[model samples]
Target: MNVAADPAPAARPLDISTFREGGSLNARLRQMHEGLLERVPAVDRIACALYDAGEDLLKTFIDSTRTGHSLEGHEFRLSQSRSLSRLATSGDVRILDDIPALVQHGEVHSDWLLEQGYQSSMTVPLFDNGALLGMTFFDARASHAFPPVAQRDLLLYANLINMSISSELAALRTVVASAQMAREFAHLRDFETGAHLERMARYARAIARAIAPRHALGDEFIEHVFLFAPLHDVGKIGIPDRILLKAGRLEPDERQVMQTHVELGLEIVERIIGDFGLRHLPDSSVLRNIVGGHHEKMNGTGYPKGLAGAAIPLEARIVSTADIFDALTTRRPYKQAWTTAEAVAEMRRMAVAGELDPECVEAVAAFAPRIEEIRARYPDED
Candidate 1:
C-alpha cells in the first residue's frame, strides 16, 4: 500500500522525558495525542481509542478535531469493521490504500467520515507487552494520500506511544501496590481487629462523600482522601515495637511516644514522594493534619498537634469521624465492639461535649444506616 508521505520534517527521536510519571492519565493522553499530531504532517485529524479488554471494544478517549466532526465519541464494535477491528483485535497496523473499496466491502465506517470530509486514513494498533492497548487513526481530506513509507513511520510512532503509556500504567500500579502493602502492615498493628485497611478506606470514602455537599469538597479531593486515609496510621511504623504491639493501656510517657505516630506517618509519606520524585505531592499538610490531628479533641486537647476547631483540615475531620466510628463498632483485643446504638450515643455525647466537630459528628450520625450497609458489604477481613 502506498501511504501518503510524512509531509512534516523528520520525526524526532522519542524522548522518555516527554512522558512524566504521577500525573492525571487523561491529561497525559491528551498531551501525547497533541505531541504526535505536531510531529506527523499531512494528518489533519487524529482520533485515539483506548481498548477496553473486558468490554472488547474501543472507546474514543481523545479526539483532537471534534468540532463538527463525525468521528468524535464514535464507538466501533470489534465485530463490525473488518479491517480496523481486526487490526485492534490482532494488534496489527492496517494501512488502507483504497478507502472507497473498504467502505464498499463493509470494512470501514465511512458514512459519518464522508459527511465530515475525511478521506484516506491510517489505523495503527497500539500494543504493550503483547497486549492490545488501543488504536490511533490519522485522516486527511485527500483520497489515497498515505503511502507505505508513511504507514511504517506511523506504526513506529504508535509503538513509541504505546511504550510511554505502558510505563505510566506500571508507575501507577506501583503506587497502588505500595499503598496496599502499607495498609496491610498498619492493620496488623491496631485500630480495629478483624477490620482490615480496605474497610477503613471505604468507610472514609463514604463519609467524605456524605459530607461533600456541605463542605464543597471536590470529587478529586474526596478520592485522594479515601486512598490517603489508609496511610493515616503509617507513622506507627516508626514507633517502637513495644509501644506499637503493647496489649494494654499506656502510661503518659508511652502515650506521648505513641502519639508521635502522627508525625511518623507524615514523614513516611514525604519520604515516599521524595523517593519517587512525584511533583506536587498532594499537599502533605492536609494529609499530615488528618493523620496527626484526627485524634485531637475539638477543645484543643488532642495529641501530637493541639489543632482545634476549624484549624484541622476537613478531610482529616471526615477521616477522624470515620476512623473513630469504625473503631467503636469493631471488636479489638483491648475492648469489645460497642453496639451500634451505644456507639451512636457516645458520638452524640462527644458532639455535645465539644470533643468532636459538631458538623462532622452530625454527618456521621446521618450516615449511620449507610455505614452499617458498608460494613455489611465489606465484612471484616479474615
Candidate 2:
C-alpha cells in the first residue's frame, strides 16, 4: 500500500466561510460535490451515504453524478457489506486502483463498483469524535486515478464535510429553540399545556413517518412536522383574553372571533419573517402551512380559507389529528379530560365521518402507547 501524501496546493482549499454564516449541511455538501468534480477531472462520480446508526443501515442521501438515478431511497445493511463495515470501523480512505483485479478476485466491493461502471474509486469515511456519521465516495472510469495524493485531498474535504454537518446541526437547534420560545409565549395566554404540545408534536411525527412511504415524504419532511407542530396554535396569543379564556362554551360571535386565530397566526408568522429578515430564505411555506391550514377540514366546512381535502397541506393535515387528539385527551377550562379509549374512539368516528384525515387518524392510533408515554412524561403542573 502506497503511503497517503499530504494535500497538494492545487487542491481547492476546504472552504469554511459558509460554515461561519451557518449554511445548511445539504447545501454545503452539494457545493463540495461540485467542487470535487471541478477540481479533479478524473472524478466521474461523487456520492454521500449517511449512516443510520440506530437502524444499522446506510442510506445514499446525496449524489451529484447520478441525477434522478433512483438512488435517493436506497438503503443497505452495514452488517451485510463487509467492505463498508470495514471502512466504518477503520475510518481509513480505501483507494481502489484497479476495479478489474478486485472483480477477478470475487470481492464484494468490486461487484458494487462494477455495477456503477467505475474502474477506480476512493471511499473516505466521515467521522465526528470517533463515531461514524457517513462516508463520501469518489469514483472514476480511468484506472490509477485515485492516487495517494488524491486520497489525501479527499480526506481533507471529508473532514470539512463533517464540520459542516456539526455547524448545520447547531443552526437547526437554534431555529428549533427560537420556534419553541414562540410557542411558549402563546402558551402563557392559551389553554395549551407544555405536555399537550410535546405529545402533539410526537403524534404528528408518528403520522408523518407512517405515511412517508405512501406520500413520498422523507426524513426531512418528518422532522419539519415534528418541529413545527407546536406552533399550530401560536396565533392564539393575539386573541383577546375575554374570548380565549372564556369559562363556558363560546358564543356565535365569540366563535367567529376565535376562528380568526388561524389568520392571526399567518400574519404573526409573516411579521416574524419580516422582522428577522428571513423573507429571502427558502421561504416560510412550512410555517404557513401548519398555522394556516391546521384547522381546515376534509369536507370544506373548516375555516379561514375553507380548504378541503387534498387542498390542505399534508403537514397541516398531520398536525390537525395530533392537535385534536391531544385536546380531547387533555382537560381544559370548558371540558374535562376524556379517557384514552374515549378520545381515540371519537377521533376514529371523525375519521369515518369525513371530518378528519382517516389515514392520519389511523397512524396516530397505531402509536397509541408512544402517545401515552409522552403524555405521562410531560404531565401538566399541579
Candidate 3:
C-alpha cells in the first residue's frame, strides 16, 4: 500500500508570463512572439515602430520576425502617409488582408511589405495614457491569416507589448526628467549647458550608430545612450557653487574636489534609481556606466576608477568621446569654441595618447558632417 501511494507524480504548473523579464525590449518582444505562436501559429512577425514627435518621425524600434528580414534603421515622417497619419490621429486599427492591394496607396511601408512578402498585416496605434507613442504591427505570410479569432489574440498581445514599451520608456523619462529638474532647481541648468546636453545626446547617438556594426550593438543600446548622455554631468550639482561656478581655473585641491563628481554622479544616479523603485529597469546599468566610467581614461590616467581600454564599458567610451567632442566644440567660460576640424584632430591626438578610445574618436571623426549639422541645429548660446 505504501509503495503504491509513492507512485503519484506532481503536475507541472501552467506557465503564462512569457514576456515578463528584465532585458531589452526586443528580447521581450521575441519572447512574446514565441508565446503567441503557441496559440496563433499564422502570425509571422510582431514589430513596434516608435514615434518621435520632436521630428514627426516614426522609426523601426524592435521586431521578432521568423523570416529574419527585419526593417531596422528605417524611419519616415508621420505626416508623409495619409493613412498612417489618420490611423495615428484617429486611433483606427488597420487590418490589411490584401497587402498587395495597398501598393496603389504608394506608401513606402506598403512597398516594403510587398518586397518582404508579408501578405496580411494588422496595424494599430500604441499609446501611453492619452498620448500616442507609435504603432504595433502584426504581419503574416498568408493573406487573410488574421481572422476574427486571430485578430482578438493579436490585439491582446499588442496591448501587452505596448505596456512593456510604454512602462519602460516612462521609467526612463522619469529618471531623465527628475535629474533635469534637480539641475534646474540647483541653478545648474543654463542655456549653454542645456544646449550642450542636447547636442551631446545626438552626438552620442551618432557615434553609437556609426560603430554599431563592429560592436554588435542594437537599437535599444543606441536609444539608451542618446537618452543618458546629457546626464553625464548631472553630478556637478553636488560640488560647491564656488568650484562648479568658478570664473577662473581650479586650483590643484579644487580640481580634486571637482573630479569627485564622477563618483558623486554615480551616487546620484543610484539614489534616483532606488528612490524611483527602478532597480530592475532594463539597461539601467548603461546610465550607471556613463556616470561612473566616462571619466576613466583608456590609459588608466583618468578619474575615480583607473579602468583602462576595454575595461571601460562601451557606452561609457562612446559618451566620453561625445562629451569631449562637445566640450571642445562648445564655447566654454574659459575657452573659445574649437572648429570641428580642430576638435577631431585633438581627439585623434588624445586617442593616440591613450586618453580616449580610438574607435570612439574615429566614430566622432567619421560623424563630422552630422556633428556639424547638430551643432547648427542646437548651436551654443549665440
Ranking by TM-score: 3, 2, 1
Clash statistics: count for each candidate = 10, 0, 0
Global lDDT of each model? 0.65, 0.73, 0.85
lDDT of 1 by residue, 1-382 (tens): 9999867556655433443544444445446556655555566666666665533556555545633453433345566666666776676666655565556534345666666666677888877677777777777766776777667666665665667656654543455456456656756435434344556666676677667667766444555665567666777767777887787889899998988888777777666666666534444455566676777777787766787888877777777777877878887766887877788789889878877777777767776776665677666654
Model 3 lDDT per residue over 1-382, tens place: 3455434334322223766776788988888787778778888988898887755778778899998488776678899988889999898789999888755556788888898899899998999887889999999889998998888878888888888889889899899999999888878975337888888888888888889889888777788898898898888888888888888889999999999989889999999999999998878999999999889899999888898889999999999899899989988766899999999999999999999999988888887876776777776665
| lDDT: the better of candidates 1 and 3 | 3
**Candidate 2, residue 167: lDDT:** 46
Best by TM-score: 3
lDDT of 3: 0.85
* Candidate 3 worst ten-residue window by lDDT: 7-16
- Give the range where candidate 2 is weakest over 10 consecutive residues by summed lDDT: 66-75
| Residue pairs of candidate 2 with colliding backbone atoms | none
For model 1 the TM-score comes to 0.57
Candidate 3 colliding pairs = none
Stronger candidate by TM-score (1 vs 3): 3
Off by over 4 Å in 3: 1-16, 104-108
